[model samples]
Target chain A: MQRYKGIVAYDGSGFSGYQIQPNGRTVQEEIEKALGKMHKGKPVSIVASGRTDAGVHAKRQVIHFDSALQLPSERWVKAVNGLLPGDISVMQVDAVSSDFHARFDASGKTYKYVVYTGSIRDPFKRHYAAHYPYKIDIAKVKKASEFLTGTHDFTSFCSAKTEMEKKVRTVTNISIEQNTDEIVFTFTGNGFLYNMVRIMVGTMLDVGTGKIELQTIPSILTGRDRTLAGKTAPAEGLYLWEVYY
Target chain B: MQRYKGIVAYDGSGFSGYQIQPNGRTVQEEIEKALGKMHKGKPVSIVASGRTDAGVHAKRQVIHFDSALQLPSERWVKAVNGLLPGDISVMQVDAVSSDFHARFDASGKTYKYVVYTGSIRDPFKRHYAAHYPYKIDIAKVKKASEFLTGTHDFTSFCSAKTEMEKKVRTVTNISIEQNTDEIVFTFTGNGFLYNMVRIMVGTMLDVGTGKIELQTIPSILTGRDRTLAGKTAPAEGLYLWEVYY
Candidate 1:
């Protein structure tokens, strides 16, 4: 069997989540079903960089799977895309080393959280961005983001449901950019625990809005308590942007 | 009673069309329902600049309604928006003269059609853009658009189901802009017949793809036959951008 790497983009609104579940539709289930059809009823499995929550979109999510069939990269993309639904697309495909693992071999990941600060919520962006009607100081948001950058034990910034024993992850960069009424928070890190990016964005928003003091960021990080942080942001605003190997 | 002019925006995916019908949800029905609730089920009606086909979005659709209760502009916007669904938004509200009419007082209108030329369909843009995979010459599109601009009898570029008696309309501008994988065709005109913008876009795309010769644009206009033009573009890619007073 030859391993193939593929890049996928999906609108996560219609999906329950990225992982396979017994009751609801999932991205993994759809993709595996498409691949299985190509394999002539033989089930095929896929490994993603990580699972994304329901309503969390992906710009370029990476995945790897083993296939017995031989095909060119372009044909693989077209053939698989033809089988997939309109909400999920297979963008690019390439044969990879059999030893390469999609989840374990990943070096880093980048995520973006979109915040709509408009006085009125835009209908088109309702499913893509979190609406924050309160006024926020951009400078305070920037200052708080600085405290989030770099390696730290992000226990306070991770969901309590995370199964990982080690809560430590290195955040390589945190950048905040404002485009008109939308504030985009980009986070680049070596690794992220469950809901880490959403938690960080939530805390920073609180800091920007003066609900949480900027100076309290250090304590929040050091406390290592989930309750000490701000509320978890909505899943619709988050996007799994890229995976680097 | 005071006439209130409102600017609205909507994601047309869930809506049947801009007008109210016997079945299926519509933007007009939702707005009137919201206003009816505010007026204690008195059933308020609104008149839009024009009707858009099913799956056609609206960036700034202008509408006017008469209400007996007097209220501030912002309050009107907030009250209506609070009652409306997430897919529709009330952008602005202003008190206008009793003589003012949304349909009759409009001097011009602008519509935009989005075309996605990417190799792979983008999942996020599936509902917002029309996918045209073939390579096309932008210069050819621009040249064809020039012939379509200004005063012309656009019978060939109109739907066969149109009930309008006059096929003449002044197309003030037709600008083609390419942004990466998307081509946006913006058309400004005094008025448009049924499916005029979509038909024009379809014909221009054919010219760009060499399916139709550039010199035949004049004949298509002179022939005044719907069969002489290209196919009508999909409704999902068309947007009512603005209505000018």
Candidate 2:
């Protein structure tokens, strides 16, 4: 079987998360179903870069699958996109070495969270961004983000129910871009723990609102306790922007 | 009674049209319903700048209504928006003179039509733009649009089913903006015949595709026959961009 790699984009609003479930639909289920059709009803399995939570969109999520069919790269993209729903699309596809793995071979990742800080909700972006009706001190948030950059123990930012024992991750970069009433927070890291990006954004928002001191981020990181972090941001605002390999 | 003017925005995907009908829902029906709720079912009527065909959006549709309720401009905007559906929104409101009219007093209007010219359909913009898979010669379209600008007998562009006898209209400006895979056509005119803008765009598309010759536009206009023009473009790609008084 030849292995194929692809970049997929999806609006995750209709999904019950990326993973397959007994009830409701999923991105994986749709792709696999499409693959099954391409394979003449034989079940085909595929692996994605990672599982995005429900309501979290992806600009380019990577994936890999094996197939005996020998369609060209562009044809695979067209065929898969034809079978997928309107909310999910295959952007590009290419042949990959048999040894290549979508999840394990990933070198880094980037994610973006969009926050709309407007008094009244913007009708155009209502479905894509998180609406925060209060003003945010952008400078304070930037200062707080500085503490989040670089290699550190991100256990405090992770979800409390996470089962992973190793919470140390290397954060490569963090930047906050403010455009009009929307604030976009981009995070690039070697890897992320469950809910880490959302928790970090929540804590930074707390700093912006003066609820958490800007200088307290280092202490919170050192604390390595999820309770020290602020509440998790909503999933709709988060996007899996890129997967680097 | 106080006369109030407001700027409204709507997605128009769910609306049947801008005019009220017995069996179908429209933007006019929604706003009037909202107004009735505010007036305790007193049944308030409003007039818009003009009617938008079904599936045509409005970025800033001007509307006027006379109300007995004593509310400030901002309050009227907020209250009406609260009562309106999520697809429709009131952007701004102001008190207008008693003699002011939404339809009759308007001197000009601007409409925009969006076309996505890419091999792959953009799922995100599926609701907002019309997708054209074939490539278009933009320079040719620009050349054709030049002939269409200024005063002319636009009978060839109007819908054949239209009841109006006076098909002449003054086209003040026409501009085309291309960005990435999308092209936007903006039309500012003193007035437009029924389906005039759509027919013009369709003819321009034909010119861009080499189906219609550039020099044929003037002759087509002189023909003063609806059958001589290109087909009417779909309503989903059209937007009432602005109205001038």
Candidate 3:
């Protein structure tokens, strides 16, 4: 069997999450089902770079799987996409070394969170962006994000449900871009715990709106308490942008 | 009684059309239903600039209705939007003259059609753009659009289902904007017949792909034969952008 790596994109609006569960539909289930068809009733499992929560979209999620089929790269993409739902797409595929892994070899990840600040809600963007009705100070938001950059323990910015033992992660970058009525926050890090990005955004929003002191982020990180941070931002606004190997 | 003019936008994916129908839900029905609720079960009607076919979106559709309530403009927008579905939004509302009409007083309208030319299909844009797999010549499309500008008898570019007595209309502007993997065709005209903009776009696409001669647009307009033009483009790519008074 040959191992193959692929880049996939999904809308995530209809998916329960990226991982398979007992009842709810998932991105992994749909992709595996499609692969099973290609394998003629033989089940094929896939390993993703990581799991995304429900309603979290991905622009270029990486995955790997083993297959006996000897199809070309484009043919694999076409065959798999033909069987997949319209909300999920297989963008490209390439043969990789047999030992290459999607999850283990990953070096870093980039995620983007979109916030819509329009007073008038936009229907087209309802599913894509998190609507923030309150006025935000961009200068304060920028100042607070500086405390989040670089290596730090992100325990306070992680969900209580996270089972990972390592609460420490290296955040290499945090950038904020503001347009007319939208603010996009981009984060690049070695790894993120469950709901880390969303929790960070929520905490930053608190600082941006002057609810929390700007200098409190460092204390919150050292506090290592989930309750000390702000609420977890909604899943719909978060996007897994890319994975580095 | 007071007259209110409102600007509304809708995703149109879940809507059957903009007009009321027997079985399928429509934008008009949703708005009227909201108005009925606000008026305490008293039936209310609305007049739109025109009706869009099933799956056609609208960025700024104008409508006028008569009501006895004297709420502020923002209140009207918020109240109606609260009752409407997530796909439909009332952006703004204003009190207008009782004699003003949404359909009769319209002087011109603008429509936009988006075509996606990416080799890999995008799931997020599947419902918002028409995917044309073939390579297109944008220069040819621009040249053909020039012939379609100004006054002309556009019967060949209109649907045979039209019941209007006169098919003569003046197309004031036809602009084409091409980006990395998509093309947007914007048409501004005094009026359009049934499926006029879609048919015109379809014909231009044929010319763009060398399926039809570039110079034949004039003859197609003058011939007034529906069969001479290309097929009507899909409705999902079309958007009613604006209606001017």
List iRMS for all predictions: 0.6, 1.8, 0.7
Which is the leading candidate under TM-score?
A: 1
For model 3, state the Cα shift of residue B172 in Å: 0.3
Name the docking class for model 3. Answer: high
lDDT of 2: 0.89
Q: lDDT of model 2 at residue A89?
A: 83
Residue-wise lDDT of candidate 2 within A80-145, one digit each (tens)? 888988878888888889999999999999999999997655555665788786778999999999
In model 1, how large is the Cα lDDT of residue B33?
A: 98
DockQ of each: 0.92, 0.43, 0.85
lDDT of 3 by residue, B1-245 (tens): 99999999999888899999999999999999999999999999999999999999999999999999998988998899899888899999999999999999999999999999898888888889998878999999999999999999988998887789899999999999999999999999999999999999999999999999998889998999999999899988999999999
lDDT of 1 by residue, B122-202 (tens): 999999999998899999999999999999999999988888889999999999899889999999999999999999999
Report the lDDT tens digits of candidate 3 across residue range A11-66.
Answer: 98889999999989999999999999999989999999999989999999999999
- Residue A159: error of model 1 in Å? 1.0
The alpha-carbon interface RMSD of model 1 comes to 0.6
Which residue pairs of candidate 3 clash?
A: none
Model 2 over residues B86-146: C-alpha lDDT tens digits? 7788888788899999999999999999998877766666667888767799999999999
